[model samples]
Target chain A: MESSRTILTKIFTDYYLGAAQAKKDGKPIAYVTAFTPVEILRAMDITCLYPESYAVVCSASGKAGDMIGSSGMGQFAGDLCSYSLISLGMDHAERLPYGGLPEPDFMVATNNQCGTTLLWFRLWSQRKNIPLFMIDYPTGSENTDQNEYVYRQYLALIEFVKKQTGRDLDQRVLAQQAANSRAACKLWSQVHVLNQAALQIDAAKLANALFPIVAARGTPAVCRYCETLIHEHSRENENAVIAAQPSFRLLWHGYPLWFLPKRYPSFNDDRFQIVLNDYTLWWDLDYPAADTLESLIRPYTSTYLNWLPQRRIDWTEQLVRDYAIDGVILHANRSCRRALAHVIPLRDHLLRQGIPSIILESDMANPDYYSPEKMNSQLESFKESILAA
Target chain B: MTAVDPILKNCRSMVLNPHHRRAYLQSVSARSCGIIGYFSNYIPAEIIAAAGFHPLRLIGCFGSVSGPALCDPMCSFVQDFYATQCSGLADLLTGLVFPNSCDSLKVLRQVWQTRPDGPQCWTLDHPVNTDGPALLYLTSQLRRLASELAAASRSTVSDEKLHAAITEYNTIRGLLRQCYAKVEARRLRYSDLLAVATAGLMLDRNEFTRMLQEFAGSSLSQPLSGNPVMLAGPLTDDLELVGALENHGACIVGDSVTNGWRYCSQDIATGGDIYTKIAQHILSQASPTAFDLHRPSLAARAAELGACGIIFLNQERCEPHVHSYVKCAAELEQQSIKTLLIEVEHGRPGLQARDLMRIESFMELL
Candidate 1:
């Protein structure tokens, strides 16, 4: 049986192989962000690359610094999203992993994630001289009207793809893709539900498992990985009755530092284990069969990124109860304003519900904004708060 | 003093002094039902006005300390706002509105919502893609906002009131256009002109229109000296930045900044429903916030103004302007126009020596 690392490695290695083969076959490569509706491209038989994932790999491999440093001379600001900058910097960097992201024929991004991604994709599209098809996801109430608004935009996107790629969208293929996404999302949710049981693995392992889930949603690869994750956790649940015991379980809010996952557990001292994070759960979406454009637009518009704070609060409160969480760690990531800005209210609500929470100020991708000594001290204090509770 | 002189004097008083302006806002807002404060330029001020509320644009005071909750990488403008709120400066207003203009404002609204003592808040989702559906979405938001304001202020916003508000706002916009035309024709000082525009944001609509009418009708004459330059950026109402350039003899003839031309350049269509007209007018403007994938409107505005050059003042961490101005500057250079790009903190003090040198050098090149 292959280990989790081997699976991750194969997934990453196969992704590049797929890109190279697509390039050789003269297939159109569409660079997309994580929140982009890439299933459309999949239905159209176009190759797609997720730059947000590549940025994670760049940060993890410690090559992000070189990429960032080699970007335009003080052109990009230091305070902008480091993930987007690393992706932008890869264009001019002297070195990159796996020969860096290939030049794309075009790009597509949805504004559901954050406005920064929209701007980042726009800048990249202009710089790369590629046509961009953007789907606008206006924030506010997620009523039927908003769903229709997004559906109309998705139809326009289909027309744009047909015009650009010379291939019309196949409804049968879209339905299949939507069905695949629903299956994968259901399996992913089941895996999280199983985490409610005494899990043998650490939070770092859970976070690592989500990389493929984020980059390969709606694909069989994700379904397979999630199955393996559930199997592994089930086996561990029977064996580690002693090791799974902890001072208290923690519910983490905000994006994690992919490059420095160890920075969190290094100071944990086995006192607590982070049970789950918001980003991993951001994709547990359910949509109907994509026989119609409305079904296709439903999942994209209903993602956590499009949710209001009140809805998010209700969801967070549900998770806190379901996971038997003892406390919360909220990272006010400097790079992620949309996610970071709302966690304060979440923390306040959690505290009112008798769940102690701490706010950690740091950036997820940039190490310059993180201080280990400071974070460690905070962690120590947070541990004491849990003990008292 | 003559009647127009007192009008001009009151306008200058409100425009030039923050303390006096706050006092005036308190006095009028007390008499009136609501003083609806807004942060972004995309919000329809007419809705608040039609709801019988004073539409006060919140400008962060200089030298005010923001809350520690706001950390590094936040542009100074938002920090100043958070500071203003924490320092009890925003207590005079009844409520606030936040538009989806940038990520910083989005986050600022979320943080402000967490504060128990903060004013009532509303967040408007402004669409980037200006299509038919986007227009409908904005119109719905405007209707919702108007309804909410009516409930909050206990003042009904009838069709007549909305039409009246739109007409009043259109008049103000027309007078502002005339003011900028005068500045472009080198008949008005940019600093004094900006002061009048900023004052209108704080004062009553009728009073503001009266002041603008008096200022436009006045026979105040001044020599248009220095190089002709157009200012461009997001939400820069800092008088000191303009004062710095004017001190160095740079004639600010026109601008594409949010607090400048972007505010006064367009008018709501008088034909459609008030909400539809407001949405149409907002979508018609050249928004740097929106990723306008067309001919660079800023460059077009520069060319139309016939200015010798353009000065793009951007906040350090501002993503929208920073992403485009590099390409914008290059495009302007292609048109044989000089461009100066200066990075400064929002609401910070006057320009540094290096920024002054860049401005001077650009002027010399022009």
Candidate 2:
């Protein structure tokens, strides 16, 4: 029987290979941002690829530095989003990974995640001379207005995909896909809940387990992968003997440092168990089945990073309480300004709530920004503080 | 030393000193219902004007102020705004409007709302795509903003008031175009042109128009001597960089910056549903670095200005302009046009020695 980690690796590998093959077979391939409506593309029978997820894979594989250097040769600034740099650099790179991403037939990006996606996809569109469709999600606005605005874009997106691929979207197929996405989200949520009950799962493992949900959320494969993930965790929870519990059960508050999977202290240490991360819960939303497109507006627009800081504070407090989290680790990801901007206030709020949190500054995909000496020192001090408390 | 025109001197003082600008707004606030502050060029000042409130563009402040510390990686423009707000300069305004222009500003808006005694805040959701649906959505957003502004000021925005405001701004835009043409023709100094443009953000539209009229009527046509260059970037209020470039033998003949030409390059059309027209005008303008598509060709603009090179200026930690520079630089290279990239920390007092040396070298290269 394949381990959950093996299954996740295979799932991502197969997806990339299949996409490369699909491009050769003359199938339409669309590079999409993480929070885009991939369900629509799936229902239309178009191959959807997430450059962001693939960038993470490249970072984990230790090839992101070369790719970033290639991008720099093209005059892309070193401070731009590392995920974008990785994708942009792939075109100029000498060695191709996974046969390189298929030249996008078209690109779809939603600003629900961050403003960087729009710019990154625009660069791709310009480079490939392909049509790019943007789904705008206005932050810090009224919910009704945001919903109406985003829902209108969803309608427009359908027309755009049809125009690009010459394929009509079947509403029934979309409904089924949305159903699968909802099921996967529910199962993923259960995994979080299960982790809260028993800290038997490794956070690094869970981060890899998140690929299916992030990349293929509206497909049955995600639902199956999530179920398998829940099963594995449940089995561990039941069969494992209670040894020495971790001294500190911490919650990570931003994107994981994908390039430093093995060296990340929380993953390597037994005394510190990273029980929850904000990244894993980003897609743990329950969608309503009544009106698929209309319903997507609320959950899609109201992503954790998309909300006001107070809502995130409240949600973090809830997670800390529910998960019995002892301390918090805030990854002040330099590449993600939207996420980084809210960290200080969040740290202050957590401090006021009597919750100890430490901020680790590093880029998600760029290893150049990661000072292992500094990180290890900070983690050592943080562990001591946690133990003292 | 050159004799500075009184109007230009007044504009320069108002732009260079935040206290002077604040005092001016305070005096204006006493005469008007209230002052409404806005950020970004995408915000329609006509609506704020229609509400009988003074529309002041917050171009940020110099140096840091005592405030809740934002992270170091946040853009300098946002940091400067927080400095201004924390310094109590923003207290003169009754409300503030923040356009969803960039990620940093969007985060600032959310964080600003968390303040207990902060002024009434409204967000204008600018769409990335400039199409029919986007126009409709933006129009709706503008309508909502108009209603909110009216409600805050306890007034109404009649079509007549809106049209009047539109005409006043259109006059300002036309006058600014004349000033830009003078600068491009090398008859006017870029610093003086910049002072006029920056002052417009702080001054009443009518007063700004009068100031420009006086400057335009003056026979100040002295062909400035320097290597002609075009400055392009996102929002910046670094008045000294313009002076620094000229000091190093580079005359900034034209600009695509938010605080410069992009502010007054397009005028809202009259004789229509004012909201729709305002939306259309904003969408049709050369899209800012924040917007995803329809970016105006910088190389073509540089060629039209007859610039020997293009100076791509970016604020430190500004991701949008940095990303834009990559594409624009490639395009300029293909055109055999020389380019220099300069990143400055906004609100810093002066240009770094390294940057000055780079500017000198770039000037020599051109």
Candidate 3:
């Protein structure tokens, strides 16, 4: 693992400098949340900024948690709640890479987890005196309401664009960006889909490529970057079924790429291939850039982990059949309770549907909470259960 | 006390009929009769009577059978209350009054505030000591809570009536303290004291005092072991947790928990002094409730009340208690008072295996 200083330096050099350069060059750089509809932002020619992204940068740099803890923000160790503390302490945790914490014209509060997070953002907006545009979800509604709520949040996307950048939410731009996002998602999905053939790319290439998907989803550069990979793969006929894509191609949920990066290779054993993860997929698929906001974002595709959670569960169902996987390693994440709670009923349902499911408890960040030995033991026994099934 | 007391009878029936507890709550909500919630037995009786609502002491989940859940068992109990609230069982709680003694109650107040139906809640920021800003805070919060309760219950927080409630609660506190002494000295089993405590539910303060006197007679069938096990954690009048620990090789010797011990001697004064004792006692009780002196240094508390071992039952997710756990453990160990730390998120769930293991290990060392 890279040290905190190294990660901070890299984030500073790449995304922050790039965003600053883009802003100076008269190309608009609108920042949205991780939970915000990137297609909507892309349509407005706005760049995305996940507040949580800055939060992670602060936490990894070892400032966010400490400052938050010391600043009477909260007792992370006391509550054993890393999520609340990290978020409450995001601002003072570290220096802004792009200088002054991405003075985006507006901020968004997504109600995916506990509504307290929304409250946290509200207090933040009050403190910062920023217009905190809300991304409302249908409170406690499982799937259908969530999508409608996400769609409602999309309406604010246009309003925020008009307010922030003094430009109308051009439907043409959204549709074009949606198309670009779809193309990128397709490429990204192909990259994951090719994992069925195992070790399709070198470890370094795969790790480096994973970044553009996570951090640069709606960017033209990312679309071009992924497009190159697709073209290159097509020319080479790469990803030949490497040892019949392990019998257990598990869909590892939670923010794996960030929280428990060490556990990344824990699934690398021959029999179990962690086929798709939620971290990067949170950004894939934008609408073809368009004039109308509705038409623009209409072409956007989403996973269950997306604002479209119906799609999340639906994707799992489809993957269960399509991938012919034997089990699901439901790495139940504590920070993302909105996502983790979904797994309880899903676990029961999957069991009835004859799919093996294992729920392992963990906090997303600060690997201290995750017991790798315990999780590995659980999976090993669960593998036996699958074989028995 | 009143001929048309729909609330008091409702609370009694709910306690008696635990299974129908959920249904009874719906009826309370149907009438828009607000619930009066108290965290512990230390609750002032006059306040419940004045509030004109059934006093509800929501107990922890009922058993320890579901131990296999990876998380702590108390969390299951807490989830039970949360689930019930979400399902609208306790929706009738128009207002809640609680002594600020534990973080669990603090979190519960937060949860109650956010429920679909707005339950006007007030923290009786009771002091851990009889002095300091806690006195001012508690008095002010209680006065504010009085008006809020009246609005919810469709009554007035008449000063005269409030004085009466304080007197009644003070009387119960006085009697409970005397009874607690007997219980502490092994003169009586805690069950006798519990009977007197429960009698506070139906009987008025003076009447309840007489009943307790009658109950705490020189001779009782059950025996009280002199071995004082100081019952800790946010307590309830429903000594289920205490009794369970007793059943599992422990006894109720002494307690730091306010539900029983802290509120025992409270004597709410009358007039401008109406909020006087309740506020004074509550604030004095707010110190991190372990061995009373920030753990490891509990000679003051232990010597004040003779105790052999300390049982620390922290309400799970109740951060303050959990923080004090290791420190309390080390401190009690220093005193050679083997401490049992039970992380109870909610009280209903029985002794978890992890807790049972902890207890066994502690007992073995002792």
Candidate 4:
């Protein structure tokens, strides 16, 4: 009978509890990025710690700026990836709020995410003097042979983990983990797909649901989390009615401002509501069945950031059309350069289709870099433009 | 001032004059020679040359601001290219190739691909790990790139052509080694040697070799002075920054930057499929790109140059150089070497005075 919020709180609380216990249990921990092949690590029975997700926790708790300040002195640059800076700072600190992360026994990452994470993870490996395993992904999908290379790297990573942990990667376990991952993604996709067509859920509620969707994929918890979220939305829509009959369905681009969630009223408001977000939907990518190496790695290879530019644009255009989006509000986050790369070009594309869009400049974590007054004014102007269009 | 050699004068003109370099590149296209831009120094020029395309290194022009048009945290180097694209200069190229070196460049590849007016763009994996599998993967990537370049240039890059390209580039690399060796030995002025090297990357392969060979053999040596320091970083296209360091009584005896010594230090192995050889050669060198684990060679090169100190100047938001410099500095410090780290936004005019003062203060300590 627990609400989704209560269930979410228990999931997060359990995550930290397990980490604390793992440290005491002499379990080997592998620090990883969100996009890493967690299935393999799970098969190897190594505890995975996602530092980037921890950075979000710190940022939400409003300690990111102070944490980053300490690390940015001389060892790290102020302009380096804020997620990395905050993580490094928290690592070097004597004490932290949510408790310190366990010292990593090893590190692993794939370049499918921004190349920054590869470097960020490398720094951790060097600092801790632990082994680092990597899989280099070619940027686009044109060369399927690139997957052959990745499959080889995957085997190499398995060899590395076996050498380090004295555990072998069982094909049976890998297949099951892959199946679990596929199920999680399928459920996650339903939430976004439903929201795109019908504004059944609000942005804030979806944002809360996306935390577990990002952090705890390929697990029973996330599968249930998604199902519970979808059920709640369905129940809410049973007797639900659009309060204002919003004239414009806008798409929110980039990471949601976690620290300041109330910036825009909930999507239930009469004004322009954010009907979709491409960034959140990126994690909802469905993975093929893991019958072979290619199928096994399909979950990682089919990542949104790893897609070709044309393919990304095509999918986005389809989403915009299906949702009947009036405009797109791209969060020009000061911390994330990869997402900002397509801002102008996408704006121009939407413009050609008679859609009005605006780029709201701010930071995802570092509020010092964000101007609330400026954002408010920009949003006001954007709303006016969308209405006019 | 010493009497400048004629070849040195032309090299200096090209290095100092952006318009002259632009005009020369324009003329290369008029002859129906395909002009392909390779984004970073890590890309093997022999592949493009083998495909009958001029492998023009595309470091954007130095004076413009990207102006709040894109994300604030994006590197200015990529931002400058975006700004230049809007200004219609990217139309001059037959194609563009980007090495998957860092986040900024990777994102720039996507941005360029989205532009309707942008030239044909291809992204290649420059392996971070120098292991056997990494080299093998890079060989496949290079072969793919050569095939793409051949199609773009409307020619076939045969094995024989690739071998010839390798030999030609190796010859230039050999001369550049001698050029940098002379600078380290104080037989050549720091800025003069750099100007010649910078000009070489812009000019035709044979013309650059001819001029650099002449410049390397010339006798334009004035007595070298000032405290010698090795300059190392990600990007150093700003000659003003180099001059500022020199003006502060710190002679740049050697450098390990994208536009500096890393360009010409390594040579391809002879007698192979040539693409595999190119991958081996590129992996053979230590990259300033982040994620490269070992950099003892950088310290060794600085020590061999007899530089009393090292100045690691990097652009802000350039994580690779920033992270690498810390480890490199520690290794240098263990050898009793002094290091100064400076992070700035390159291509901004009128910030030289403050930087020069910092360099001067560091020189005073030396």
What CAPRI-style quality would you assign to candidate 1?
A: medium
lDDT of 4 by residue, A316-352 (tens): 7888888878888877776666666777777778788
**DockQ of model 1, rounded to 2 decimals:** 0.55
State residue B313's C-alpha deviation in candidate 1, in Å.
Answer: 2.6
Give the clash count for each candidate. 1, 0, 48, 0
* Interface RMSD, Å, model 1: 2.2
Tens-place lDDT digits, model 3, residues A249-340: 66665555344334353753677666656444545444444434444323332333323333455567676776566787776655553464
Predicted candidate 1 versus true structure: per-residue lDDT over B1-366, tens digit per residue: 544556546656664456777788878977788688998778888888878788988763434544554655666678777776788866877899988777778778767766788889887778777877788877887788888898888988888898888889889989988988888888887777777787787788887887789787654456688888888877666676777888887999988777777887777877657688888887886664466522246677777887888888787777777777756766666788787887777646556889888777776777
Off by over 4 Å in 2: A1-6, A73-76, A140-143, A235-244, A267-269, B1-4, B60-68, B87-89, B289-295
Worst 10 residues of 4 chain A by lDDT: A261-270
Between prediction 1 and prediction 4, which has the larger lDDT?
Answer: 1
Of the two candidates 2 and 4, the one with more favorable DockQ, higher being better, is 4
TM-score preference between candidates 1 and 3, better one: 1
Pairwise TM-score winner, candidates 2 and 3:
2
Scored by lDDT, the top model is 2
Candidate 1: misplaced stretches above 4 Å? Answer: A1-7, A73-76, A142-144, A236-244, A261-265, A288-292, A351-354, B1-9, B12-16, B60-63, B66-68, B153-156, B219-222, B293-296, B333-336, B347-366
Q: Give the TM-score (0 to 1) of chain B in model 1.
A: 0.92
**Which pairs clash in the backbone of model 2?**
none
Query: Rank order by DockQ, top first?
Result: 4, 2, 1, 3
TM-score for all models, in order of appearance = 0.92, 0.95, 0.52, 0.93
